[model samples]
Target: MGVTEYSAKKLYAHLGFANGRDTMVAEGYRMDVLHVWGTHELSTADLLEWLGEFSPQSVEWIDDSSCTLRCNIIMINESTVLHVLHKLAEPFDRRVALTAMAAVISTMNTHNNGGDFERALRPPKLSPVEGTSDRLMPPCGRWFKSISSPERALCLYLRIAHKG
Candidate 1:
């Protein structure tokens, strides 16, 4: 599979941790896997440069095809993965960024019950004073209310998570 397909599958696998057993397994696991793929001309240095501040614990190259190269990056935590996703969004594919975001959100939800995941997914209750307009707001509207942008919200979340 290509980089995008690999990322999507990894995200789905992480989402499966919604089940108790999988969540427990994921909690016990200390490393996160990131797949990076490109033409054979792409080098490890290039990929690492693209990753920016997020450093991987290890990188394993898979030369499965003549024209393409794939690397499995072992990262320290979900936060590092989030950092990588943010970098990817800036220069790489936007879909990869969304996939990574969904994976991290799923991971956060599994770990914390009263986190942004709950707030983002919860349907907003219509305020009697405001009438039914509140119902029209998307579920994530409340989560993003205090944050000026999605990137800022992500940074804020990472900051809070790092503090604890």
Candidate 2:
């Protein structure tokens, strides 16, 4: 769940995984898992900065308009999915973390298709939208939502999935 030092959108789409930024051309390795922040409001620069550092082989599907997703893999890896889920809590809702994590597990694909991403837009547990958002996203969760806790829930889901 720990994101490395790479927040550039260029890194996310540099591989041209499919539906990536126009700046990217050639395709890179698709991911084995994916995490779509469908409702998260991200600036072009911010999106690029965060996604730019992806391993290309880490994502499987995307809801990114300015931020799409794609991935490659034989089977879904619980740890990989859980890792990404835990990272999504930052600047986003906590209750929705579980929902978002589930969505990622539900939407892993090689081709970049942002289907039914709106479901992720709503704030988790009735949380108000943050004032500092770079873009307009639907509100989710309570204002007091803790970031790390939600990630932990996602991790739980992944652990269960791993066991199953």
Candidate 3:
């Protein structure tokens, strides 16, 4: 719908994942999907497919330009997408940055947890994207996290997803 959403969606599609929402990260979730927590591994091609399809906008690609994305822990059905992805592939490890594999209880402090205008902490104490808590978060559980705010650059893609 928007430039950022288009970029995210483009990234997902490029990763070979079925279109999420005709946009970026907010795309719809397909029923045929399957995942395993740190066990089921996907090829780098598949992972790349999923990330490349997301629309790219407002981002400049450079040989060394990179951003560390922090996401909350997430669990869907029987697997942890982020964890497994990172565990299964060496490229994934470079793709994601968790800093730690364990969740810290202090992230829920609210006072310092993201504060009023800061980016959300990884393994978020409370992940509004997944509508769940990160009490026992792991490094590989970042896949299911996404902000739902349309105004936020990171969450803008989710806003265009199908309202399940």
Candidate 4:
């Protein structure tokens, strides 16, 4: 996607969307479309640099060439979302572009809910207690057999949820 120099300067000044830094308070945008078509060489370092510039919360690598960068839109607000969408518009088809708009609506809804959105997305953190994570036990057998009936059922549900 192409960003005009003027637009790039605006993003850089207001939102910290820079080419060389990881110290960003907000990642400028989220690309809803997963696939990048046409023959092009996108190096790993270049991809990582792009990710750093935008500063998404985390980047999930689909493969060497493809990755899903997730940003909690609630953190960036609507104007930045629109700016990113404007930048993304050139690379995507109409259908794919529409999905990005739809995501904006969903993200706004989550934003309206205050802390709930952030809490739901935060990964489970290990407590100060050492080896505490192991207490939950893995999804496999022998350990599964050791838990009480209710805990076992809860563990199974968690295992399925994790799989999804």
User: TM-score: which candidate is best?
Assistant: 1
Task: Flag the better candidate by lDDT, 3 or 4.
Answer: 4
- Residues 89-119 of candidate 2 have per-residue lDDT tens digits of 3233356677887677556532335444544
Better of 2 and 3 by TM-score: 2
User: Against the hidden true structure, what lDDT does model 1 obtain?
Assistant: 0.40
Clash totals, every prediction:
0, 30, 33, 0
Model 2 quality (TM-score): 0.24
Of 1 and 2, the candidate ahead on lDDT is 1
Displacement of the residue 17 alpha carbon in candidate 1, Å: 5.7
TM-score list, all predictions:
0.33, 0.24, 0.18, 0.25
Summing lDDT over every window of 10 consecutive residues in candidate 3, give the lowest-scoring window. 65-74
C-alpha lDDT of residue 4 in model 2: 40
| lDDT tens digits by residue: candidate 4, 1-164 | 45565764444343224551123322423333222111024443433354344343433444332333331211123233334434432221234445787797578757677467656656798555774444343323111111221211221110000101
User: Per-residue lDDT of 1-164 in model 3, one digit per residue for the tens?
Assistant: 12354544443443445454333334544221222122113332332333332311112111121111111111231122332232222222212444332233245444465564344434567536552223123323224333221121221111111113
Per-candidate Cα lDDT values, in order, are: 0.40, 0.33, 0.28, 0.33
Global local distance difference test of model 3: 0.28
